[model samples]
Target: MNKWLTIVLCIGLPLAVGGVSAYVTVQNIQNWYPGLAKPFFNPPNTVFGPVWTALYILMGVSFYLLLREPSSEKKKQAILLFFIQLVLNFWWSILFFRFHWIGIAFIDIVLLWLFIILMIRQFYRVSGKAANLQWPYLAWVSFANVLNAAIWYLNH
Candidate 1:
């Protein structure tokens, strides 16, 4: 396969998933989300789209770099961890925005954060650059966890 095509496919996977998640999020933003009690530190709705897009792109690049490594048990583990976290990532929008399950969403984000940590560790074993690429993602998710917690607290 062409290297460029491979890169696009890798990046597209996350972006495509993000698109679906964004769809779920958009559905709520106009009707449901505006009603929620958010933290003072919460960013405007405009901020989320660009932030998430950049993070997903970075995540795709990290996964692409990880995929360049030779197949090994560690690589396989890292791949599994990536997918697990991605699924968790998708579920967060549903839990928080669609279902309005803020408390459960907080729990999901915590588990997602842990899985991202494990994924980054495994990515390091495969490719340092790949692991490095995930830092911003981890940071954003960390902030998201705090935001989720605060929203839960404020509402409940």
Candidate 2:
């Protein structure tokens, strides 16, 4: 496949998944989220959209770079872990926003953070840039774990 196509696929898939995740988030942000007690550290709702957008794009590019590696069992495992964390990424929003399961979402975020860290390690062996790309994501999710814990504690 052409580089352009690869780039498009790399970026497009994550954005598309993020768009779907946004569908679950937008409604709750307007309705349910406003009522919840956010941590003092929580930023205004406006921050999340842009931050998540950039992170998702970075995730896509990182995944693309990883995928470009020679096919190997390690690559396959890394890819699986990548998708697993991505699923957890979307599921966290749904669990917190849509279903209103704050405690469970907190747990989910912790697991997600761990999975991201593991993926970073695995990606490092494959592509240094790809591994580096996940750093912001890991940092954000680390902060998010604290936020998630605080919110759950305050609310429940």
Write candidate 1's Cα lDDT for 50-74 as tens digits.
9999999999999999998999999
- Model 2, runs deviating above 4 Å: none
**Per-residue lDDT of candidate 2, residues 3-79 (tens digit):** 87998898888788888878977788799988988877899989998999999999999999998999988888889
- Model 2: which residue pairs collide? none
lDDT of each: 0.94, 0.90
Looking at model 2, residue 103 earns an lDDT score of 94
User: What overall lDDT, based on C-alpha atoms, would model 1 receive against the true structure?
Assistant: 0.94
Global Cα lDDT for candidate 2: 0.90
Give Cα distance to truth, residue 89, candidate 1, Å: 0.2
RMSD each, Å: 0.7, 0.9
29: Cα error in model 2, Å: 1.1
Best-fitting candidate, measured by TM-score? 1
Q: Model 2 TM-score?
A: 0.96
Candidate 1 local Cα displacement, residue 4, angstroms: 1.1
